[model samples]
Target: MHDERLANLLGAMALAIHDVMLPAVVDSSGVGVSASAALVVLGAHPGLSVSELGRRLGLSQPAAARMVDSLQEQGLVTRRKGTGRVVHVGSTRRGREATRRLLAARSAQLVDVLGSLTARQKQQLEPLLGTLLTALYRQIGDAERVCRLCHRSCCVQDALCPVGQAERSLAGG
Candidate 1:
């Protein structure tokens, strides 16, 4: 059983981030969530197969191919042959620039939201958020999907990234 108050607050926060914040950020970046997500994933992992991308985005191979076609048409992504018949998808320079803009917009929105919290309040919230993220990764079992558009640069550099640590442990590393 979960605490009702906490659950409600979390739900509200999710709504704010998803409905309010994300839409606003996406509007400024001129990229929809799905396309932006694909771009971000491509930026993070430069040479994923279309099938692998489908797995990450919870799309079927055909759907992923359609998405790739759309992105390619938009000059946002490129596809190259890999070993065997695999086609590796990568972001183009234009795609990377779009990703940068998307990330900046998201960061600006989050910064606006976080600006309301006091320094001490933010300090107190950090570990709690990390714990929640760790639990989410465990419950969902998909780190890449769970954090598709995450701009927490710290996660890339920090040894304490809960998702990274969880994934490493789960992989028996």
Candidate 2:
């Protein structure tokens, strides 16, 4: 049987992290969670269609369109006409800057949270977190959604990302 105490601690820790992380990301980007995610996604993969963006963010078509409209109004993103009725969304310079700030804020808050951990503790925690992320990717089955707000460069700098590795493994690659 699973340990209830472990589950509870994990849940509490997840909530605590969210509480610390969300405000920093939102304040830096001046957008709500979904919009912030959109900007991050766009910053990474420019010119994704609205429908695709919505799918990545787990939003409905109409909702995604409205989000695109709002972002355009904020001068954070631009929509260009694609072939036929498709609309491709890309980040503006301002949007890219916002994305950078959002990532920086997220990194700062996370670093602060990890400040209490010893270097040895952090080293130990890295593999544990990677294992958890891999398991999470297996369950969630959507790497893009799982990493929507992630600064990909950081995760990929040292080695292959655990989630990506999970994805590749699942795909039989």
Q: Whose lDDT is greatest here? A: 2
lDDT per residue as tens, model 2, 70-173: 99999999999999999999999999999999999999999999999999999999999999999999888999999999999999997899998999999998
- Model 1 misplaced regions, further than 4 Å: 157-159
For model 2, state the Cα shift of residue 134 in Å: 0.9
Model 1 lDDT per residue over 1-173, tens place: 56998899899998877776678657755666877888888888999999999888778999899989989998999999999989999999999898888888888888888999999999898888888988999998998888888764746674477887788888998
Flag regions of model 2 displaced more than 4 Å: none
Candidate 1: residue pairs that collide? none
Number of backbone collisions per candidate = 0, 0
Model 2 residue 31 lDDT score? 99
